[model samples]
Target: MQKIDYREWGVDTLFYWKLLIGLGIIVALGGLSALYMEHEGHWVTGMTNLVVWGTPHMFAVFLVVAASGALNIASIGSVFGKKEYKPLARLSGLLAITLLVGGLLVLVLDLGRPDRLLVALFNNNFKSIFAWNIYLYSGFMVIVAAYLFTMMERKANFISRPVGILAFTWRLILTTGTGSIFGFMVSRQAFDSAILAPMFIVMSFAYGLAIYLLVLMFTFAQDNRVIGDNLIKRLKNLLGLFILGMLFFTAVYHLTKLYGTKYHGVEYFFLVDGGIYTLTFWLGHILVGMLLPLALMFCPRFSPSRMALAIACGLVVIGGLATMYTIIIGGQVYQLEMFPGMTVINEGYGTEVAKYAKYCPTVPEFLLGIGGMGVALLATTIGIRVLKFLPETLADESVS
Candidate 1:
């Protein structure tokens, strides 16, 4: 095995400081937004009885799931013995930690009762997926942290493969738990399904890899580090494969629903009549997120272009958000059927059960969601600067 040298990000101090300051401002604003919502209550935000989980949940879920996905690079290198992937493992581990932290921050802050966080943390209710996630999320961080230790410390190098395998299994479980949070809701028309667990796992793969690619490119470019074409090709191809898997699971989910008479109404709402939700489903999730990215990755003309791959990754991210919004918010917007045949009318507002629920996210809500990204990037920036998380170079000779 050829010795590979690792180094701290070599960007100038001024650029690093500027980036830190910018990220700090975003994180500070997100904190303030959370505080504002906490003080004013859920009334200040867009959440209601119908749509309880709004934009923050979407962002939080994306981050949490993506966090698991981010570790795939390290897993591929250490567990699967892909030498080409070994050079990027450190950044993968760091990103996995930071992304989860940023996600958990948003989740905790948005909990309406932030003061009761300790109670939720300590009180283990085995029945709830939400409760299970407390353990999953914390355990994932600790395990990945240990995994990173084995990779970084020369004395601990012998245990890296075992630790990598452990981390890989744990992340799959974590993503499953995250997805089951939605999948277990049998009462909700939109969430009632068994496919969501695997669907979420596939989603984590696509979203996480997309984020890893963008971050890898940005950091490598900033420091003038080389990322060889072979590595880029592998990553882009992997991303496309994940996207196809996501689409496959999605098709099965909707097709299964469509086959059942009980789910016909909800399927109709998503595929046909549901206004913004339908648009988001087709344009945002299907076209931009899935199809466009696949085109960029597999198409001969665009596949060779780094800029094109970047755009595809960006589209995946955007489409991921759209998918989350349609799933989280749009799911809630469609009213649930409490009675199989009877229509319940709201006497006060003269609204029928068939009427869709209304929710519009406020500015503070957007700020809070955006802030989570800021937190993740901020930590990533500082982590690479303060430690040897990034490799000095990834030229073909070094990687292959």
Candidate 2:
């Protein structure tokens, strides 16, 4: 193994200071939002009994799942002997750890009683998917951080292989746990399917790869790091394949729902009647997010530049976020009728029900979500600068 000295990978002090300033601002804004939520209660946000967990929760979950997926390149290289992925290993590892921390922060702050967050950790609900997710996420974080540390230590060759395997195993379990969180919600028609778990697993790959590509572009642009065009093209090709898989799963899931008697009404409302949410799912998620980017990457003439890749990545991420939002919100849009005897169903039976149980996130919630993104970016930037995680110089020697 060839060792690169930390001194050779140092970032400029100006960039480091700027990152700190950005982090500080984000922290201040998040703190203020938390305080406001605490004082005013959960009423400040769009959350109600009907929509107990809203956009913030979806964003947090997406980030964590995406983070785990980002680490796959490193995990695959170390455990599965895929040497081509080694170049991305260090950056992906750092990103995985940082994004998990950021996601956890958003989740903790969004809690009605942030102090009671420990209840989820201490209380054991063996049957509950949410309970399992808590454990999985914590375990994944530990394993990934340990693996990252071992990788960072040039002298620690013997431990890296074992740590890498552990990280990879735990991340897979963690993603499954995340998927099961929604899958086990039997009461919700949108999430009751067995396919959601696998769907989320695939989604993790799409989001993870997309984020890694974007980060690569940003790092290269800012620091003049020499990532080969060939590498970028390879990643884009892989991403295109994942996008196809994601689209397939999405289509089959919906098509199967339409065929099922239990879920038909809910499926119809989301696919046809649900207004902006439906539009978002069909156009934003399916067309722009998946198909268009796939075309840009896979089409020979349409091979994207670094800037174009970044834009595509951003669109994919936005679409992924919207997909999650639609799932969570769209599920609740239709209310089930408790009264069985009524001939004419209530106006609130389908898409109309969401209007009554309405939720538009308050300014505070939006600010907090924005702050989370800031925190994630600031953390990544600082890690690159000070932690010697991102390589500043390309190694001439082959990775062992």
Top candidate by lDDT? 1
Candidate 1, number of clashes: 0
lDDT against the true structure, per candidate, is 0.92, 0.76
Quote the lDDT for 328 in model 1. Answer: 88
Cα lDDT of model 1 by residue, 121-144, tens digit: 788889999888999999999999
- Model 2, 124-218: lDDT tens digits are 88888777777887888788888877887778867988999988888888888888877777777778778888888888888998998897777
- Using TM-score as the measure, the top candidate is 1
Deviation of model 2 at 131, angstroms: 1.9
CA shift of 118, model 2, Å: 2.8
Stretches of candidate 1 exceeding 4 Å from the true structure = 342-354
